[model samples]
Target: MANGFEAAMRMMRSRDPQRAEDGFGLLRDRAAEYLPALIEEFENEQADRGLRSWLLELIGLAESAEALPVLAAQLNSQDEMLRDWAVAGLTRLDTREARTALWRARANGTIA
Candidate 1:
């Protein structure tokens, strides 16, 4: 079962949007145990734009406060797209910290 879940996560990182969305949906439904692993995979996959974006969307759907630090880290990403997505994800959270981070990123020119 664990291996199957891992495999599903790997599929979620696929280039195909449908596959990614399906896998992410599964994980999102059963995310209690997989959250840590998903966060690690998403953070490590910074080079894959599609995967990263999908991961961010997953994180947004998860709406776990645990994702705050990971999303915050991306605020410093050299990739403008990643930074923008991070800000957007944080805004989706709508927490005070998330809002503050978004404001700071915008002020610092990391987001626009």
Candidate 2:
């Protein structure tokens, strides 16, 4: 399954929509179990911006409390796309911490 997971990750980075969708389906199904790995990849893998963004999306979609800090930190990202995803993630989470972070970002003018 780990090998399958790795393959799916590679497929997720593919330019082909079908491949990416298949990969996304597999990862999304196992997101909770793979949340830590996804976060690790997002944090440490600096080579592929697209891959990192995908990882962030999956992390956000997981909707776990563990994803709070990762999403919140991205609110300060210079990358507007990442910031947008962060806001979306936090909004989707709707936890106390997530809301607090959103409020702080609003107060700081990090978001609208």
Candidate 3:
């Protein structure tokens, strides 16, 4: 299982579509345990832009409560992609906290 996480990280970072899909499958299944690291990577500004976006998308797909803070933070990002992914993640979460965050963002005109 430990190695699976490493392999998934490597695969998801790959440019190949099939490899990334397989990696995403593995990562998604282990989201509860791996979300923190994934969120950390997503927060790395020095990371590759495409990889950062991909990481954000994966973080949204995980839908873990642990990811709420990061997802909510991204809601106000200047980057449209990040904001969109954050909204999707929050919607996926659908928890009271997530919904509240979304509501606040909407009220603030951060989202439509």
The candidate scoring highest on TM-score is 2
The 0-to-1 C-alpha lDDT of every candidate, in the order given, reads 0.75, 0.88, 0.84
Which whole-number lDDT from 0 to 100 does residue 26 have in model 3? 80
How much lDDT does candidate 1 score?
A: 0.75
Q: Which of the predicted structures, 1 or 2, would earn the higher lDDT when compared with the native?
A: 2
Task: Order the candidates by TM-score, highest first.
Answer: 2, 3, 1
Ranking by lDDT: 2, 3, 1
User: Which candidate's lDDT is highest?
Assistant: 2
lDDT of 1 at 38: 68
Clashes of each: 0, 0, 0
lDDT of 1 at 23: 85
Residue 60's lDDT in candidate 2: 89
Per-candidate TM-scores read: 0.76, 0.89, 0.83
Clash number for candidate 3 = 0
Q: Per-residue lDDT for 97 in model 1?
A: 90
